[model samples]
Target: MATTQTFICFEQAASRTDRRKNRRGYLVALLASVLLLSACEVRLHANLEIEEDESGTIAVVMAFDDALASMAGPELGDGLGEMSAQLPSEWQAEPFAEDGFNGIRITVPFESLTELQDALTALTQGESGSDLPVGELMGFLGDIIPTREGDTFRFSLTMPAGMDQALGEELGPMPIEASMLDSVFDIRMSLTLPGEIVSHNADIKVGDTLVWNLSFADSVRTLQAESMLTSAISGALIWVALALAVLVALVVVLLVRNRRMRPMAHSEQVPEEG
Candidate 1:
C-alpha cells in the first residue's frame, strides 16, 4: 500500500485545546493490561488502535514531576514539538499538555506494515525521529514495536534500555525507603492488534486487546528481562495455517499414491495362461 509520511504533534502555547482522551468505550472489553510496577510513581501511557487495513490511531501520554522535568529541561523543554517533528506531516495532530503531564494524539487514517518497520527501528534506537533521542521525547513512547505473522499483526510496548538510568540520573533512583516504591513513576500502555490474541504476558487481558497498568519500577525490570508485554494471533489465522499444512500433506500423499498405483493399475493382464 502507498503510504504518505506523518509524525506526532502538539499545539502551540497559545492553543491548549482540551481534547478528552479516547475513552476506549468500543475497546474496553477488548483490551487489558497484565504488568504492574510496585513502587515507581511516574506514569506514561500509550494507547494504539489499528484496523485490519493497517489504518489506526496511536496516542502517547506521559507525566513527569517538576524536579525531574527540570533536570532534562535542556534535552526536552520543547516537549510535544520534539516528538511531533519526527512524524510525517500527514499524520500530525495537536498535542496537549498540563501542569505536570503531556499528551500526543494522532490519527493514522491508513498505514502499512512497512511504515511500522521504521517505527520499530526508531523505537529500538530510542529516537523518535532524526537527531532527537528518545530522552527528548520522554523515553516512554519509544518502547512500542510492531510484529507480523501471516495477515495478522502484533505490536508490543515496553521500556527501553538506559531510560531508567536516564531518569535516575535526572530525577534520581528509587529510594530504598519502602514508602517510595508505589506508583511514584508509572507508565500505562494500551493497544489492539490485528488478530485474535494467542497468548500474552500483560497484567490484564480482555479478549484480544491489551491494557498495561504498570509502574516505572515494574517496566524497568520487565525491560531488563525483555519479557513480552503483549501478543496476539488471529483465530482465523490458526485455522488457515492448519488448513495449508493439511492441503500440502494431502497433495504429497496423492502424488505418492498415484506413483504407486500407476504401474499396478496399468499392468497388462497375463493372457498367456488363459
Candidate 2:
C-alpha cells in the first residue's frame, strides 16, 4: 500500500510538471505572436482636391470626400500628415477644420498686380472673338481689377456682334476675381475614414475626420516675378542712355559740319609791291 501511494504521488508530480511545461510553451508562443504582429508594416492611401477663389488668387484644396472615409482615419491622416511632414518647405498649416470639409487652404498672393491682370487678360482673349454678354465681362475681370478706398475703374467688355447657344453654355460665368484673396486666403481639405470593429491597430483603424487650413502670406513683400517695376526701370534707363548718346553724337556732327562749311576769310594782304 505504501509503495502504491508513493507511485501515485510521483505520477501526480510528473503530470504537474508536464502541465507547467505546456503552459510555458503557450506563453512563449503568445509573446512571439505579439512581437510578430507589432512588426507588421502598414500602407496608407492617397486622395486630393484643388480649387481657387476669385481675385486671380489660387487655392489648392485636397480632401477624401466621403468615399475614402470608409477605410480608416489614421491611414488617411497619416497619408495627408506626410504632405506636411515631407513638403515642409513648400507649405505649412494653421488651426484647420475639425470635420466636414476637412483640409487646408493654400493662398498664393498676387505680388504683381499688373502681372496678374495681364495673365487674366490673356486668358480671356479668346472671349474677344465670342459674342459673350456684357455682364459676363464684369464677372471675368472683377477679380482682376484692383480696388482701394478712393480709386475705382470700371471696364466694359465688347464681344463680337453675333451670338450662339453653344458658346454661351460652354463658357459659364467668367472667372470672378474675389477680393477675399487680396492679402491672404485659405485652401481646405477634408478626409474621412470609416470605422472598424476589434481592429488590432485600433487607433489607426477607426474612421477619422481631418480638416486643415493652410495660408500663403506674401512674405517677400515684393514680387520676385518679372514685374512692371523692373520692366519700366529697364526701359527708362535704356531710352535715357540712348537719348544722351544721340545728343552727344549730334553735337559732334554739328561742330564738324560748321568747321567744314565755314568759308575761309582771305588774309588781308597789304601789297608790299607798291
Candidate 3:
C-alpha cells in the first residue's frame, strides 16, 4: 500500500510538471504570434528634419492594418495609451487614424544631434522605460546615428546580424515563414537636412528629402546620405565678398571725383592766364 501511494504521488507531480511546461509553451507561442503579427500587419514611417543649428524633429507614425486591429481588439487602444504614458514628458504622442489605418504618432523634438541620437537609441533598444513589445522588436532593425563634420552631416544605417538567431533563441522557431516577411514587413524612413544633399545611397530622393524603404528580405542592408549645411566659414566668406565689393565701389567713386576736379582746375588755370 505504501509503494502504491508513493507511485501515485510521483505521477501527480509529473503531471503538474507537464502542465507547467505546457503553459510556458503556450505563452511563448503567444508572444511569438504577437511579434509576427506586428511585423506583418504594422506599417512604420519615420521622418527626421534637421535645421541648420542641428535642432530637429523626429516624426514617427505606426499604423496597424484591419487584421491586427481586429486581433488586438480593445487591447490595442489600451496598449497605445500605455505606451504614451510611458514616454518622456517632453515627447508628444497622439492618436492617429487615416487612410483605413489606425495607430499612434509620436513627435520628438531635440535641440541637438546628441539628443536626437539618444532618442533613436532609446526607441530601438526599448530602454525608454516602456513595456511595449514593439520597442523590443525594433532592436533588430538597426541603428541611426547622425554625425557632423564641419559643413557636412553624415547619416548611415546598417542592419545588424543574428536577428533570426536571436528570435529563435528566445522563442524557438519563427511562427511565420521567412519568405513572407518581404511581402508583409516594410518600413520607410526619410531624412531632410537644412541644406543641399551632396550624396546618398537612398532608394529615393525627393527634393531635400532622402527616403529609404527597408524590408526583412535581406540579411543585411546599408543606407547612407551626406548633406552640406551652411557653415560659419561660408557665411564669413559671403560677408568678405560684400565688403570687397563695397570697397571697390568706393575706390571707383573717388577716381571719378578726382578726374572731375582735375578738369575744373585746368579750366580755371586757363581763365587766370587769359
- The digit string of per-residue lDDT tens for model 3 on 1-274 reads 3322332233245553443333323322444355454553566778889888889998777777776666566767876887788765556889988876788888889999888877766665434522334444444333777888878888887864323533445444555555454445456889898777878988899989999877654567777888876565578779999999999999999999999999898887775445
Name the weakest run of 10 consecutive residues (lDDT summed) in model 1.
26-35
Highest TM-score model number: 3
How many Å off is the CA of 271 in candidate 1?
45
The TM-score values for the models, in the order shown, are: 0.45, 0.22, 0.65
Tell me the tens digit of each residue's lDDT in model 2 across 1-274.
Answer: 3322332233245553443333322322332233233332111111121112113342233332332333334554544464444332223333234344344333233444454454334322323311111112212232323321112212122222111211233222223122222111222223222221111211131233333222122221110111122344567789999999999999999999888666543333444565
Off by over 4 Å in 2: 1-227, 261-274
lDDT: worst 10-residue window of model 2? 218-227
- Candidate 1: stretches off by over 4 Å: 1-43, 63-91, 95-110, 117-143, 157-164, 168-184, 219-274
lDDT of 1 by residue, 1-274 (tens): 0000101122221122221121111111111110112111234566676666666666555444554444445444465466567654444546546666544554344387566544534542432342332223334454556655546566555554332433343233333322233325355666676545545666676765677665423435341111122332345557889999999999999999999988886676534564
lDDT of each: 0.45, 0.31, 0.66
| Candidate 1, position 229, lDDT | 24
